[model samples]
Structure formats: structure tokens, C-alpha cells
Target: MPGVIARILRRTPDTRYAELADMRSGFNSLAAKVQTVLDKDPYGGNIFLFRGKRGDLLKAFYWCDGGLCLFAKRLEKGRFAWPRSDSGVVALTTAQLSLLLEGFDWRQPLDAARPRTAL
Candidate 1:
């Protein structure tokens, strides 16, 4: 579960992502074309971005210093909230992805909606 791929839903345009120099991207040529907007983008050396043609689906590329890896996901019913065109990409943690999957906005300040309580 820790190294599994997680997806962001929404038909995001291929031009939304900018590539970084600190990482190597291994998406196919089609995926590469969609990432042209990110040709020289920077992620502060923590995250990477990838785009797939199937309705704006994206995969998050990341590494733990030991090696590199990719995480992918898709929304069967809705689109993801994209950042402003002028804004940089959003970075997410594994825990954050789990929250987002349950319909929580990971960027906002919120308490757990279903915290367990001792009887």
C-alpha cells in the first residue's frame, strides 16, 4: 500500500504540467507530449507530474531517495480540482491521498470527520 500508485481524477489538460530537472520521467511519448508545458518546471526536489490521455488522469511520480516510483489514479465519477494556471503543481503525501480518496480536501485545515472515540 505504501508504494502503490494513486490517481487524481478530472480531465486535466496535458498542458497543465511542467517537467523538472531533478527527476527522470518515463511516460511514453504520448504522455510526454502532454507534459510539454512542464518542460522546465521545478518541484523543489520532492515530487514529479505525469499525464495520461484517458480523461485527464494523472500519475504522481516520487522517490524515497533509495529509488524512484510512480503513483496513478482515476475518478470514475468526478474531476479533480485543478490549481490556477499560473500556480505550480500540488504535492500530496500518501496519507493525504487516502483522505482525498474519501472526499476530503487535503489542502484545507480540517479535523478528522470520523475519529474513533473510546466508550
Candidate 2:
């Protein structure tokens, strides 16, 4: 499971939708966009991530287990942190993706407290 997640995170989507409602689109429509607009295979097993204009909702589209799967997340208290660029792909590590999904700043994650002394 970790290996699969790692592999998927290594391949970031080339495009991102600006509206959350747009992500509400069905599989066919999303697949069409992925095919025509991005010129990428919708069934190629790459994960595409989309964020809403308000940054509170996020959607992930990918091909999985012989079919397509769409996963969505909506934050209740805080908005998701996203890249400033409205276009192009953004590569992320597994940890960064996890942070993004958890509504944290993936670019500069909060530092952990250092050990007071070596054991």
C-alpha cells in the first residue's frame, strides 16, 4: 500500500481545476478533460488532483483496479493550501501529498521539536 501511494505521489497531475464545483463533474467529463486538455491518458494510472476556487474542497482522479476512482475531501474549519500557479504540473513527495490532503502547507511543513539532548 505504501509503495502504491509513493508511486502515485511521484507523478503529479499536469493541470488543476480552479472551481470545486467543476470537480463534481462525472467520470466521463473528467476523463475527457484529462484526455483532450491535458493530452494524457485517463487510464494510464496517473493521479490527477483538482482544487476548488475556495480551496476547501479537493478531488483526486485516477485509474485503479481496472476502473476509475474519484476521491474527494472537504475541510470543515480550514482551507487547503495550494500552489500559486494556476497551470502546469507540481511534483510532490509522499509526505507533501499527505500534508496537502490534511490541509497543511506542503511546501514548508511545520518543524518537529528537536531533541533536548542526545540519548
Candidate 3:
């Protein structure tokens, strides 16, 4: 998870990323799936929002080093609190991903990210 961040893009760009920035090569099935999804669904929408049927598994795919990598996460408690289609994919940091994987609310602090000034 070095160099690459585990973020859920709240507003992913039109061109989807088959692979994230820092995914390692070899033994990565998720990346290949992501590419397939992108190839089939090129609506310029976020691929992160796409849900695969695996029962409590969330997959993220990427292409790196001339290969594909697939990332999977499973929650012991509940399903991921995915953002709305209108909001787009919500990007999360590694730490945030950890929290989200455990079914915690990762978007709380962001709601109050207002600038502060000393009076």
C-alpha cells in the first residue's frame, strides 16, 4: 500500500483508472477485473461503485507493471457504506479503508473540514 492511497473517490473523473498508483504486480486478480469492468462499462462513471457478487466482498481492480491486480476487502459486521451514485465513488486513505472495512464511519471529519481563524 505504499505510494498508492486507498481512497473512495467521491467524484471520480470520466476516464477511470484501471490501476491505482501504487499497486504491486503479480498475484493481483482485482486489477484484471477492474479492466474488464472498464472495458464493458465505459460510461465515464466511477468503477469503484461497481459491486461484484461475492457475498461480503468488495473488489478493486488495477493495472500496473503491464499486469492486472485485484484488491478485495471483507467486513465482518456489515456491508460497506457506499456513497450515492450522484456523489460518485468516495476515495479513502489506507487508514480510512481500514476503518471502513471494519464498518466504521469514515466520512465524519470531512463534514467538518471548515477553515478556522483565530479571533
Which candidate gets the maximum TM-score versus the true structure?
2
Which regions of candidate 1 fall more than 4 Å away from where they truly are?
A: 1-45, 51-56, 90-119
Candidate 2 is scored at a TM of 0.74
TM-score, candidate 1, is 0.41
Model 1 over residues 1-119: C-alpha lDDT tens digits? Answer: 32234333211222224333222345344244334544532222344555444433555554344544455556666544333344454545555555544434556756668857866
lDDT of each: 0.43, 0.68, 0.43
TM-scores for candidates 1 onward, in order: 0.41, 0.74, 0.42
How accurate locally is residue 60 in candidate 1, as Cα lDDT from 0 to 100?
A: 56
C-alpha lDDT of residue 17 in model 2: 35
Candidates 1 and 2 compared by lDDT, better number: 2
lDDT of 1 at 36: 58
Error of 3 at 92 (Å): 5.0
In TM-score terms, candidate 3 sits at: 0.42
